[model samples]
Target chain A: MDQKRKDSASRSRRRFLTDSTAIIGGAVAAAAAPAGALADDKAPSNGNLPPNVPEWMKAPGADVGSQPYGTPSPFEKNVIRNIPKNQPQYTSSASRTPIQDLDGIITPNGLFYERHHGGIPEIDPAQHRLMIHGLVDKPLVLTVEDVRRFPSQSRIHFLECSGNPSYTAMKGKTASDLVGLVSCGEWTGVPLKILLQEAGIKPGAKWVIAEGADAAAMTRSIPIEKCLDDAMIVYSQNGERLRPAQGYPLRVFLPGFEGNMNIKWVRRLHITDEPVYSREETSKYTDLLPSGKARQFTFYMEAKSIITRPSGTQKIEKGFNEITGIAWSGHGKIAKVDVSVDGGKSWKAATLQEPVLTRALTRFRLPWTWDGSPVVIMSRATDETGYVQPSFEELTKPRGLNSFYHNNAIMRWQIAANGEVTNGNA
Target chain B: MATLKVAFAAAMLSLGMSATASAQTHYGIGRPATAAEIAGWNIDINREGTNLPPGSGNVAHGREVFEAQCSSCHGNKGEGGIGDKLVGGQGTLASAKPIKTVGSYWPYATTLFDYIRRAMPLNAPQSLSNDDVYALSAYLLSLNGIVPDTATLDAKSLAAIKMPNRDGFVADPRPDVKDKRCMKDCKP
Candidate 1:
């Protein structure tokens, strides 16, 4: 029965891909062709399945009630965020989707990466209200409905936890095992500037204190200019209301900022003249230098790229393989992604997927023939700002060992002669 | 060449053993943390002394420490330069334009100690001793007029110290009871 289900699922997926591709091709052809060529191209026809089908295929009767809520397909039950146990009460370590195991950038909401400081807060959306107080002209209290009423916009972007690759920084580790705390999805929400405009900011409002409604009451003081710029109060992910783990009903989405700055379960936006000196901003997220002067407010995540397939854990049987992965930058669009198979000795540019927007995940793919020999693979991304992703040595050189956060170094995966994979640096 | 090969083998074997040992050991390597080590590290003191260390200090001694250690960043009178303004500007929260200095905005007294001990001095973080941290906390608190000049601040007295803006903050009551139950029914 499991085999049959698998077969059906594979067939359906193939059909979906083929049909979608054909439809897209036809649309493109029709648009490019002359007016008289319209009838020459016909839309694909749908046919009913044979009557002698499985019981599950039969239409649900009145006894089977309709479901108001939805869940992921049962076939995808195994796909889940793997949370590594540390101390009790502290879920400090977690990993997201094995992106190599999946196709397409839209990670299923259930399988999204999670990194929680305390734990996921069980927040009731109905009871959640966002208060805009402090340096605002009018301290406005907004319900979820009030937010939804505003003109909404949808954007596709990746939210990657900053501590995504701390495990692999040591080297010789598999790619996904090291830095799997990243997931990309289409986020839908209202621009934060619109709401801030509604509230009317005072002249002295330089910093805005964003506080979360959780046991930790996580808070961060974001710059007022950023709030007025591209900040989003997102409510939906991939055409559905956000999952509880992904900040349920409402979350602050600051494009280009590190994931920590994107406050989840948002409760209040206090417009203050100065920073609140929150624990996250001051102590946790701040980068401690060897010189003792810590680098605080390192908000913008620098450009970085990784070759996902033919990476650490996934095996390739010494033949033609497509090296695919994601490249993104908080600064701007990924101008180029260079992949080096022979360590950093030489580099070849990878083909970047289309529509590479600023502060968005740009997918890159490279075709390579793997001989059954030991080889090191790495990818380096250069953003529009002309800042190239540094090597681990280069990143650590100036910062020294005291540095903990914001280590966007080039990752290396070593393919042993025996086909076993290990971290190159280790 | 034979000696080099043997050395390489030994190094590889040691690497393997270390990896195995790392897998077995739960916490990262270091001496088992003593009470002194824990106390030495966990000296974070918030404005209300949420995690103040066990030590006593007075404003006079605090002022001396502040001048020697803190005055480079914060001015002599706690008027901030490169760092932050730590004193004056009280009761400015509700004004059209509020000067939200430490005296005005901070809701807890313990937060001062927490901030100072964790990352302060602008040059060296976690460098101050417990007594130094307490003195700095007292100095900052007295400068802000939260505590008297002669008042001693320690773990015991720090939590008891009331902040001016302590009552300013309120628990969020949004997504109210009405909102929670209003899914099916409307107002009569």
Candidate 2:
């Protein structure tokens, strides 16, 4: 099976190269073609190569409902989320999406990154209920049906784990290993504000503690302002029911917040005047500074970007290679991404893909000509708040390497004369 | 007819009182959670001592509970096995190897009780009684030298016991690094 997958991957890679050339050449030719010449030209192939119809053209295709639920093409099996080799335990670990292998903005439900605390719990939707109490005029229990029946809205946003970046243990790992802990999808759900208003929040309520039904009962205390701002109780992903790994029944979706705080398998929310300071916020996700003081409740994931193509482990031929990747910020939409082929010494603004939404991943691409010489390529993102992605040295100087969460430092990829790519900062 | 008019006036006055008291918005969705239902799931503890159950367990009894329920995964002394090491890592947050254990890093003692109660004993979560969770928390705290073997931990004492690193945290002040949108000549 491994060999078969490798063979298919290589075939796709070859086809991609051919298609790129065809596209570039076709663009140039079409621009120069006369308006009448374009419509009258006969296509190269007429159904078949020679005297015989193509097999697909001659045969009857499978009928409808051939696959009740659709799946990605068998040829695209290589595009998947992978659990890193250094994972401490399978029960509580993260599986990263292969960012370099994907395109555009939306992450497929099957390939979205997965972070499990005590493994995925098989929740029965019929029995699932979200209880809201404490500091509320009326304590209420909302079933899955009731939660869904509330007016719903769909918004595209990115979810990134607080521990998205590699730890000090990460020295020579690929860019995918470093920054693959994020995924984007269009989430369909009711705004948390509407729900809170329904519960009639009391005057002194300041924080709302969201708890999951997983074995860990993962909990995080979100400020009332944030909860009422853009938080959602998401039930669907990418136009379909959420995949089990992405929280099948119901989950809290906080736009522009760290992934962990967007609790999955959410079951309970208790409003209070003080932060719960759960184990996650107190012991785990809190950021430690060089002064021996840790920063608590640091929820926002800063602006960051990476060169996914021509990144670590992906080799590119010299000349005419397009450097493309994703940039995002929890604060707002990515304002711009600057690509640097010669490290930070020189940079050029890359083209931002259209329809960039707030708190969502934006794809950036830059066409470059490699000169068969060693060079360092990197991309820096700036969000609407005017926050630029910082270098590793700059980030470590303040917080130090001991800080495990929220490493949005700029990533640099080294390209060798032999067309090989490696991970590094300098 | 006079009694009927008085009754209608009383009803109107009560309705007006209720409207003024609540002054709340209602979307009219979901059922009102019964007290029993709220008690079953409302398991969170804050720094100011809210929602902690009434239970006391000493370090000695906590060791027993830890051995029986937690030892398999967290090691005999909370040193860690498949689970995270609960003791040691004190004063390591600023060092090269920051060991974030229950004793060294956790800011509040209530967090330990809340965590153990909500999710601990890896294989079977929420299986331990509130007393058992308090006991395990006490044992773990004793191992870290924060509590004495004879000391008993109840909701009041637990909330009162200060963590060593309690002062080691500050509110988030972000956008820490500054870099203008310089399109060229960025690197020094």
Candidate 3:
């Protein structure tokens, strides 16, 4: 049944594209017809060409040649996440996706999610220095070049804003959600353990405070175990110098940890014996539980999945469509993603795209047949640990509604009879 | 039939309660944040005087440090400048809109000491000595009308001084009576 629906949908899409191309051809012909008679049309009359072909596209070599540093195309200028500037006190603010425009898990660096407390710091790679002090026997100050000399490893991972839960807090209410807060890319950096080993960590140094250079001087105390295990002091994202907003020069990449712990524009690393209980770790990133005992150091973002397509504002036609979206886990690689069309009462394991990396974004696709009937759709991820993504009710039961961070509830999108999609409660 | 209804209600309540306790009860998932662990990282400072480092400073000493280190962004007199306005905004919170400076807005004085120590000098952080931190705190407080210009602020004096907004902050109360539902026909 799914295959049959996909066949029909493909045919319709092909037909639509063909029709649109033909319309463009007809418009060109019409514009050419009056060229012989009208003086204004005489310019392009020599050839069957349409006027107003954008200047950049007119010449084949107009596009900039190879760039050592890459930037989004001019056509993609409108793809930026609209960040709301409320006050000057804070430096970096949140930018929402033009979800209406994006199609995949890879959010461009320019459009990646930003939740900076202070403005992005301008650090000259040569002048900027990273000091590894405290519990290390040799507290060394390494320049950007000095750090790069160490062995580097590359991995593809997704950095999500901790605020990913804020969108689903209100059930069934569709706002301008997905304003470009998520991005995925290959990050190249030196393993943090290498530096620690080089400095020779002292015994009992279990936690290290990663501090950024922003005005907020944002800081979070991360477990030393995680740092020695898989963390990296990343300097490049997507094979280039990190963008200023995405912690250009240097940032701590904590795989499988919450985004906040992955400090950006990092400048200082103090290896200590205790957690500093910085504001971000103690009072801010913590989740107030229903039990009144706040959940602290809730680091791992659990197995959660969201269907980017057919989400809040996107419109889909009734028929067979490819339901594609991203699933990730801080615990481990996603083992399976189950899709539910009947409000999660029933689920079928969706096909996970190949090359799934540990603690990385895994794209899942399921050929879904959307009947004309009104229906609700959702996806739940089961990680390698056999930990399944809990439903919204399951998550909120113990945590309650007061939580403002680390919300990994099951996201549900309602499809109307007319194919209008709305974010709704699962 | 009455007994059957009671059993059904009990079963429903059990199901509801199970849903609420979904978090995994893993032992040793995280160790208590120990003093040794706290000492490892130099970023945070709590109100309980848990992580205050050794060193002391007087208001006079702090004034000199402020002029040399903090005057560029915070202004020479702490009136406010390129950065946030840190002084003389007291008692404005109740008027029309509160000027949320260190003295007028922040709920705790420890937060001020913590923030300054962790991130200060506008350009160079962690550069100040603990004594400088104490003196800077004293100078800022004096500028904000919290203390006399000559009042020295050391570890002893700093912690005892109460912030005007100390009682302004509230703890989150949730999943309680406000969230409870009362219905005659409802089960537990």
Q: What TM-score would every model get versus the actual structure? A: 0.62, 0.86, 0.67
Instruction: Go through the candidates in order and give each one's C-alpha lDDT.
Output: 0.68, 0.83, 0.69
lDDT of 2 by residue, A170-203 (tens): 5545666888889999999999877877787776
Highest TM-score against the true fold, candidate? 2
Task: Give per-residue CA lDDT, model 3, range A178-201, as digits (tens).
Answer: 323456778999988777766666
- B5-70 per-residue lDDT for model 2 (tens digits): 556645743764321122234568899999998987788888765789988888898989888888
DockQ of each model against the real complex?
Answer: 0.02, 0.43, 0.05
Which digits, one per residue and each the tens of the lDDT, describe model 1 over residues B1-188? 66675566457436642111111111121122234433433332333444455678888889999999988868997998756677877755444334556676566666677666655664565577878878888888888878888978888887787777555443222111111111122121
- Positional deviation of B107 in candidate 2, in angstroms? 1.3
Candidate 3 deviant stretches above 4 angstroms: A1-75, A85-92, A97-105, A171-180, B1-112, B116-153, B157-188
**CAPRI verdict on model 3?**
incorrect
User: Model 2 misses residue B167 by how many Å?
Assistant: 1.2
A114-212 per-residue lDDT for model 1 (tens digits): 776546778877887777666554566677777787779998887877766662345524455666667788889988877776665666677877866
Please give the lDDT score at residue B93 for candidate 1. 46
- Give candidate 1's error at residue B119 in angstroms: 19
- Each candidate's B-chain TM-score, in sequence, is 0.66, 0.81, 0.69
- Give me the overall lDDT of model 2: 0.83
